[model samples]
Target: MNSDTPQLKSFRSFEARQDGDRQTSRSESYLRTGRESSVISATIQADSTGRDMSIDLDVSADATHLKRFVVSVDFGTTFSSISFLILPRNTPPDSLDPHILYHHIQTIDHFPEEPCLGLAESRKEVPTEIWYPKEEYLEDSIMGDGTGSDDSPEGDMPFHLQNEDEENTYWGYEVYSCQRIDTDPNQNRRMGGFKLLFDESELTAQIRLDLEPTLDMMKKKKIIKDREDVISHYLKHLFSHAKEELSEKHEYTNDCPLGFVLCVPPIWTPKACRIMQTNMVRAIQESGYGSFGNCIDNLFIVSEPEAAAAYVIESTTTVLPKEAFMLLDAGGGTVDAITYTVNQTCPLRLEAEGVEAGGALCGSSYLNKAFQEHLSARLKDEDYLERNGISIRSIVDTEVVKFENNIKRKIDIIRPTSVFEFVEIQDLRADPRKNFGRNRLRLTHNDLRGIFLPVLEKVSGLMERQLELAKMRRINVTKVILIGGFANSPSLRSFLKRKLASIKSYQDEDIPLWARRRFLVPSSEPSTRETGRDASAVQVMDFDVMNRSILMTSLLTGESFPIASLWMAGST
Candidate 1:
């Protein structure tokens, strides 16, 4: 709990005085600084609350001796992850190396099944999904069981849980697997997209229709008592898994000093941010962190875009002095864009107020929706299959969606002949119609483009708006950095490159609008070459938020003290 750390005394000693007298003393101190007169005037105006501006630079100079751990949680809309750095006793903070310093907690390691479709390798992140079995089904299973107790036999529990309640309450991978196998949707209630409900305006009619069943189930079962409870329940499971992993890996004790930083969308209003923070604090407290003695006081909130900027500025080698750049964080639920001007390169002083900031609800999930709609339309158009009483919606959801998610990553926009064959349905096998020839779905370049065009257009528009603002401010934005889960989309990357290239070459009556901006994306593989002390040793992780969280954790813990000072000054 650094919040209770002692404040620095003023350089000049003074006797106890009234509030008015203290304001006069602070104004006098400001006037006596002998710096720029405008700066002094601005300082006085900024401190209207009469709070002290002094800071003790050496407050954490001796903190290196303390045994502590820094942890960051990215509670994302589609998937959530946690990354952490451990500072052992007597380890000097300055000597820490980022290349091997951070570790992803791998939250879904012990899941009953793999989480997402086509994920062959183990992943550090977990699906932000939960499933609640119907009360009738639970009761039936309990009555049918030979053992009356809630406890299951060792090694017989699904997901290896100790109690039967956990078996009925599934999360992450189990939700997906259960939904696919059990056609009776009422048997298990699976819930996703609850994260988007934080902003009420973003809750569309379609989204509401999709969430109604789960919401009703949650209410009836008391799985979620309120909107905040939805987030708290998920977070409690996430943190509990993280605590177990950390305790085993580092042998962490109850007394170990631990700090948690949570990342939120930059475009969230102050009200939304406060709500999220309150729920997060409540979640941590209810997760049994309170027994560890004031651990909750160490919680910090950082904007997602700000954290991404910190990582790009510190980890990249090509970022130039005074160079401006645009960051596009296209996540599952939203896309946020921010433009930054680097004021200093050595200690990294970035413009606090961005040249422009914008966001939209259009994200990668919308592509899936569009694809689902397209398939539904095709099924509707072809009457040959409907005559046989085949349900098109079931075929699309259970079969087509899985194939789409897998191949969407490998789609080549330039290849017009690239075909995606639909998984054969036995009902369609007997119907030999021209439209259903070979039981294959032919995806032309235009068809493929159509699937992604709606989302890509929204993203491109956001970037264009940010670029226009930068131009209006006369900022020579040098680079465009892409991050988040949607950044992994090849179609998105290609679309942006083509769109930006056109804008760069577009002659506005012989004036190039955006000729100098360079597009940069994170490489999948880590670099092996060392850049020495002048450059950061941290290699970018596959997960963008994890990398950003690592940098944010370091910044918050005074490892990069000067950057923190600059951040505070900029906030003022």
Candidate 2:
């Protein structure tokens, strides 16, 4: 909120002024602040000579807007999107040309309704959530675990628990969720807590850049803090950053007419929906976007699957004639299936089903369990477990970290170095004396593969069950769409493909090419060949399915019955 932010202050134009007015003119402060002011009002432009030209100014002023304005923001758990609305340049509101406005409005080039899916990957949106515990509660939580904390900076966030070993500490989000790190140490190093912030001053610039999406500070507790409050705080920061970016890019003074569409998984319960909505609205307000009494209008909420569906439909040239097809959405969070009957006489009719299992929690949890079981089965007591500080448990923990951080990279490394086997371990206090044993452990790459494979199989089974239910209802299961963050994994896609192959009558070649490519098949993919499989295993992957469904829903959800007015073929 103040110009003292590092990024803002870094600019020569942001220097502090003697007769300072922070609110009235930021440009003055910028010129007088942190850095040397000699370069103030210098505009860098290119000339035909390919040399840079600079223009100096003695005074700076606020920008003015001449037309209607608006902005739309899509805040997701892992990522977010923003768009703008520009009113006609010269026409008055009453004389506005609808067609002209439509023409000027930009439609996303690919998958207009949904964010782009990276090549051969699925899942849209980014996460912007953070987690932290109340200071009052931290002591009790840490004490209940074991060992007392030392005042050393290294152990600043250390945990002391009653039952747990002193050395068995964890940190970061995993610390809270997995009960590993010392509570104090974990809280201190947590990325999303105090450390997550840039100087409120630096935020304006940081937000302008695209930050990688991750739950860096997330804790696994059921209720670490009010989710809404945290989400609102984060959003406020993001919006402020976005505004600064816009200001730097264009000149505008009046409030913009913004529209936003947020996508949620079909399985979001009423409680979750309410929480998300309230948090988002509050976040928008806290971010200063709604401060001037203007807010985003035409806000829309579409299901994850439905958004993907919209992306699919928008990309195609073919139109449906009121027939029902099932949409199976497999993403990071959960698997959802829906039936939509596309008709000419009326809007589409929709019915849906979803389950708790999603790729993020379920698939990842399964992988963890498998790794743990593999370590337990292979190592026994007194088998070099105590000497040299090497043990099966430590290896398991290290492997889990590798699994979470760079499992794919490890897989690539292991594939070339060892006999196709998996390896896993978690030894934070690893001993240098056990170098030889560590080399031997590296040879067990098959162990890692074994752990991940079973979990992939479970995901396949879930899809199969969903397909079966759709078949029972006699609904035409069209494309089985795979989406969400988890859909990006080659392992998951390969396993799902195998499942489809196993279902009766499914030919390997008959599987949709888009499915084989593991990409969200554009709606444009030809639907020429119909699989004769058990009707349950055929799934499609696409980005637009979810949004398209929402668009249709928005259009038709509350409309009055279409009246069949009296008509005669030769009435004219």
Candidate 3:
């Protein structure tokens, strides 16, 4: 003990309890006026989440010394997002609130190679992907579309994935743009959807089945030792980038205690959380974030959907007093549906929540998969029609990407298109008799409907299930706020509206989803600043327990399930 401080006595009594989804604590210290003796009794009531999180503390006036420098991560299938906030370290807890915390949250939008891609503004998240390069492609690794393998005149390759660089492991934006020459590791190796594998153990075997050839090549070519090697290595890179961004902005060298908020997928099991936590800790330790224990206090875990819901409800003007809203987190590879009813307005307390899930992996990526399959099957016989199969393959690749970026999101409710012509492939080949092509490309609206139906069916089912749960709980879904990357698709939005129109509880409202302001123009701010229903931490520390900091990480991720520009009264 410091000489000026009073010596503490033994423990008197400690009490803990739960109240819905809120955590509150108060402590009273009894100190004798004589020599030095003190007794502290604390009653901490935290949200009784069945997980290992069980602490809420009261920081004394003297303990509020250092500023809370916060950094958060969302490791997703399609993209990974990071954001940070630096509150005045010396201030006490009473001075800080949710509103003050909202403005300071800044997303790490300026990635290494993002500027040159010609984006009008900064991107909220980097693609969650990794690639290992072959020694043979020294001529260059072109990023954007080129005429052919030998015909690259001008291109914008990712800055982090240069052929001249010594590093072979490329990650994030590095892998986002780079092309995979062949399946063989002798040519190159690329991997995504690794985050999904964290949910299941045998996912390793399943992934091996899909990437058996490429993975086997990576093993033989000595790029990666095994499957875990790829995961751990990829995670290390992600942590390193986050460390760099945090360090540069705040001059934070891990000198002070770091509060980390790791968001868990909604459908993740307890076993899966443990596995992901271990890998995250290891990745942080290896990324030079100091010794993991020294920097990180507790791995604040949160459900992605809930965290996102909290962020939207708090930051925006959209308020639902004693009303339920369906929070649909439609990401790249997964869609999670949950309903939360606001019980109070002052502090925004949610009473009843219904979490009904869709398929394990159901999201917009299925549509991409469907479109790719359509192209492959439709173009396979073209090898006999013309010797330009290689060119045709290149065109299909470009067209598929174009569809994912543009066409997929354009399927709206108000205006609908009948035929979509190929921008690249203008050929006289098969499917001219039907409306599958115009320049040999007349893909009718029905053709697209056939491709979009499967994914739409699954997503619609998720919404319906959530609605049913809400009805069962007697909570009418007054509004539906859709987040996540996939929400940008108007087709999915339109389909869900039609599917749920007949539901009695919903009453066939306009039900506008929060899916605007991403591509055409971004939000006035950067990220969404999501709220955490599962674990919304405040990062209040006592600096006791031998300098252990108590971290409350409300790692609200607005970008991961991006919500900006609210709509009400079922307005579009």
Candidate 4:
């Protein structure tokens, strides 16, 4: 264990927000046996409403006392990330300046079994998918019937065959790597999206419809006993790896005070949060973290929007007071559109507006679904299929790498001539009329747009509604901050910009209010005013920013699993 660990190479000064109406609550039992107890002295300030929204938590401590470590997890629907911070113990209950904290904070850039797939670029996130091997994942099961089978007969799928030598449960990239080649859904248990099932009452009819088949399959295969079981196992994977990463980095023994800041979806009820905590505590205990006394006592649960807020504060250099922005978290499974009004600039305080959080099942998964639907229609000839020996889904699953690079991220309305070519099959004869030629499924701009527009339409509607509500409330929304894996799509941003352009003038145009109009005109050509500020409203986060994520939440299996991008933020 080196005396030093990864230093935050980026950022300077730090700021954090504690907004409430004059509330001073102490953290639970910070005492450790044979160690100095933490005593956090906080300076509280009040706003005009007599609500105490000002609190400074960054109080430097002496180097000798003890070391306090903070870990935040984004357990999401499609992908997830982990970050940690280590501070001196002398400050006790004082707050850790997020900028200074983030400077030292490091995200999990490596994972247990990261495969060598043909991805466009490496991201800090790992796939939220997991698998408990039935016949055990062998080296050679890559080609199969796309239904996620281990290429085994019904008789061989019993749980009894799971541990011939060993049946290791794998997560993240390992799941994708193994599931692509070999995985028997009938025998080996594969689970994801359970994070979304924490509260049955919060499940929309559409979510229920999407989740039912998987849940029924899990039941049929006895993959899960209940919601707790699913979360417990998955979290065990996450925590165990987190501990390992920290250990190798700083010789992170379980001696210091370890606290977790978990991010959850806003739509989750208190009961849902409780359910996730119960399972998470169990995972912590089972993982090496509970080796010491009371490691789970200081678990801090924050909403996804709040965590996203934390990320924003860490990134932006200037924030206008009274500035309002709509943060659209679009990921694999779900999209949540929430408008926040900034109360201050430095120690940023956010207040949710009256429009209410607009959440829906339209996410990147829908695009995948639409793509799969297109394949189902095109790839139907039995003989063609027999020659190919691969299902439509198998191609989609395997070519996910390509889809992400081409169709998912780059599909746009502007490129009518652009074409996206999926995996090639030399045996199947090419049919240009059906958009299949040159041995590949070549999707033109229109084809790709058809795949992206429906989902983007839902996303656009979600944003427009909030903008409308904000208009009604006379709250001007300045920037639209786009985050999440789904937000990684360029087409979505373009689509949203076009939607904003199409919006009719809020009031009858008395010479078209150029500078005063609340919403942005996406395109320069259509705006009745100067084109200089056109497309000024939309803000798409870069990949690095998305990778260096903050305000992250996790959930279990989801419409696709994101809330980080807390994806079903599974373990939020």
Candidate 5:
């Protein structure tokens, strides 16, 4: 992973060739050379096996094509999102303004309707859920178009149905948001929360047993042939939808070569990343957007935290050079933390080599699980359950989870005395009087604190450990930048600010709080005022924006440039 290694030597060779041309700028060099020269190759040496794997990349294609776009996919455990950055052929890479770049990093909000349910919806991120059709409906869906042949032209059928009938599956928010169907056992088995399973080095006997049913369903329906196929299936749909968006909304033609930058957790091993990349490549190939060879050549992988740091450094006006800062990516499935020292400001180099990194599975999804458990305990009355013919699990899943997802972000963590009222559950049962206290569930300050405190504490502990490591290295960490969906939690922000502010080193008694350190969050300002079907949701930092920043970094640093290379090489 070091820059001096043989793998990087190939990268350096490519850079040298690009720099040798005085007549053309580095970005313009691709225009003079043919498609063959646009291709760049890098080798990845496996740590355990010492096998060198060659990765062919077309990093300079953006410079060659008349129109190029970088499609960034932030594939998460609970939700998945996509964004697009159009690199206009006329604009030089170095001359491209940051403000203009932000304008092109548009979030994809609209998603295709489910084939089975025929329901359409628009949202910022699609729920990473899929449903298997029953045998009868499956046949009808597969052969409904009269031809009933798998060889039908892809253009003839619906976008989702372009693939082989057997491989076609239903997905999107409608699949998960729809009411539970009880008619068929396989009618609505939602497949999600399985993204992390791929990262496990080995599956235990019990784990394999638990996953049998889902795996069998996937295989039986011909939706996927194997475990890795699940990712391929999901990504196929995602890439297809993104292509449709670009064509219809952005007026992109097929002549434009598309580049992709996929974001993954920093904690994932090289093998895990390779597995993801392999499946994603298969997905892009099957998506029919372009040839498999061309798509794979343009693909790149980036760390989520590094991408977040890139966005913060470029978008925010407060960050300064040579200052050490920590980036905490509090995502849905995992929390990843990494410290970066700004090495340069002009070209923006944040060196994260040899820095200690920390992470845990205690993400926002766990808080939802905790809330479900809390509700179950409170509603565990046998008599009440029997009379109402209602299950605690159903109430929590349908009612309590919604409240937690929507209201938790709005809660003011500064005011500990405040209480959150939940009257949404009162209508769960027809008999309002039979429910708890006039069909209302009250959550005291203590209850609210209890729900999120444990997870937040774990995150806080991760930050503390990272800070301690920075201190041990004699690196003065001065700022913390929070990103990802879960980082929007007011309670989590308030907790971190309060907890980190009080700590003092044994040697520094007189250091002022502001001078010692600070916490930075992306501004809530909207990036653009473009009117469209799916207007981007305003947040501190949209995951898509971070993704675009990563894409920008890749173009500036070259395809062979590794983010946090030193740390990744040194990490276990």
Candidate 6:
């Protein structure tokens, strides 16, 4: 089996100076550049000392010709996207042609005499869509072959749709959207990030309790027996459809090969991760990407935030000398925080921090809850006339599916109120029952802002905590990078700038110098606050830090990872 360990490399190696003192507040000043043999011997001698020791995993490619590509997939619960990067190959290997004394050479094929140019391509967007097809059987009265009869058990199922080429297609986003939702709307109100009744505590157990009401509602409609049964049936249907599509789509039915990297949420627990991975593997196999009836080698899992990080990191030219900086990924599913550091002598170091709270979900959730409250209130004000008279059963029983007066209207009974009205009825609406229950509610921008404020606060607190931790460890942060769909919000950026500035402004004497040194006060001020005086000189910038620091640190260290590794190990 091939080794799957990812490449790790750093740019610098540290050596103790003759003047180095243990009592000094700082770690040994890193070795000055251009001093090779002298520093290497000193480092080796220092390593022999009886003390705490550590190793770095700096990885680098050899001088040999090679290519690299980075792929980023922005996958959300409801939607997904993909991006890719193709790296430039450094140098082509020397090749020998048939030694002919005659120098004259002419080819009928107008192949360019110049070497074939290799191009590295990077894609920035891949949609996250998976589709499956329903199976079909022939009519029982069929006079010919056994495509199955209408009276046969399999005949009644929906047949999978054939692709344009008459091959079945799966693994795209279109397929996922067309499938029937398995859970009851009342039970698992999850559309992307909004889980109506998700409580962190009692994770698995109460999940069903929260789901039962919706399941019951669906059961009434004869969608499925219970919530469990509904999901199972839905999965079975999807799996069957995917398999059929896969079988029909490709010419080589035995070879279903797909290359993919999945992005999961940062806060996902091991158990949750396992469940999700299992489901994904099953889905992939059913979709025909599995080898030997299983999904293994073809699948790779990276956190959604990490995928964004990889995407953004590769886009930058600035590399970090210290190789340490806070990474904030504000994406659709969640906001993830990570600290990444790379030094000449050490392997890439990464640590994940924070939770998933960034995106439109929180905003949308607040809106949905507000709307529900409005509907309930309207029902009460009308002497429960609307709620009592409108029969969900009748709609399901008759399968009316009417837009004006059927299920859609019933679902829409409760409307969300605007911020203007929300503010006007703030006190009145404080009574949860009367406010959110009524219909005809519209949430204004202010309401949306108010709902998002708390979430922003949580994110701010997390960053502050991370800074404090780094200060304790004497790690200097050079830049703070943010990416993802939510990061595109101007309001969010402004809010973060203010909060970060406030944190940086802390002048407490007890604060460590490392923290102060790392703080780069943002130049932009909050639009809401008027300031006559420019506060600090710290220049704040947002861009690709990895590429920026690379050259600088590479110069600082005499050689790159591959060369240094051989030299470092060969010395002993």
Top-TM-score candidate index: 4
Regions more than 4 Å wrong, model 1: 1-68, 90-112, 115-120, 136-163, 200-217, 247-256, 269-271, 285-290, 352-354, 380-392, 414-421, 424-427, 430-444, 505-572
Best by lDDT: 5
- Estimate the TM-score of every prediction: 0.66, 0.48, 0.65, 0.69, 0.66, 0.42
lDDT of 2 by residue, 1-572 (tens): 12222222222232222113233433432232221122222111101112211222112442132233334344433234343433322222222211112212211111112222334322222233333342322243432111111111112122221223212322222232432332222332232322112212232234323221223222333222332334444554455555664454333433543333344444444334444444455545544443433221233333455444443333232325444444444432233445544443112223333322222223333454566676556554325554454455554555554454445313432132455443433332333442224433342455556666666666666666655655565545444555434555566666666566655312112222123111121111111121222111111212222221111111010001000000011111
Model 5 deviation from native, Cα RMSD in Å? 14.7
Ranking by TM-score: 4, 5, 1, 3, 2, 6
TM-score of 4: 0.69
| Runs in model 3 lying further than 4 Å from the true structure | 1-68, 112-119, 134-166, 180-188, 201-226, 246-257, 290-298, 345-348, 352-360, 384-398, 409-414, 418-421, 426-444, 506-572
Q: Give Cα-based local distance difference scores for all models.
A: 0.50, 0.34, 0.50, 0.50, 0.51, 0.30
Candidate 5 per-residue lDDT over residues 115-195, each given as its tens digit: 231133234466676655443222335322212122212212221343344343567655544422222234335576657
Worst ten in a row by lDDT for model 2:
558-567
Candidate 1 per-residue lDDT, tens place, 462-543, comes to 9888878777766666667776767667777777877777554112311112211111111111212222221111111222
The C-alpha RMSD of each candidate to the native structure, in angstroms, is 17.0, 18.7, 15.9, 14.7, 14.7, 21.2
Of the candidates numbered 4 and 5, which has the greater lDDT value?
Answer: 5
Q: lDDT of candidate 6? A: 0.30
Question: Candidate 2: RMSD over Cα atoms?
Answer: 18.7
Residue 431's lDDT in candidate 4: 77
Superposed by TM-score, candidate 4 places the C-alpha of residue 245 at a distance from the truth, in angstroms, of 2.0
Cα error, candidate 2, residue 64 (Å): 9.0
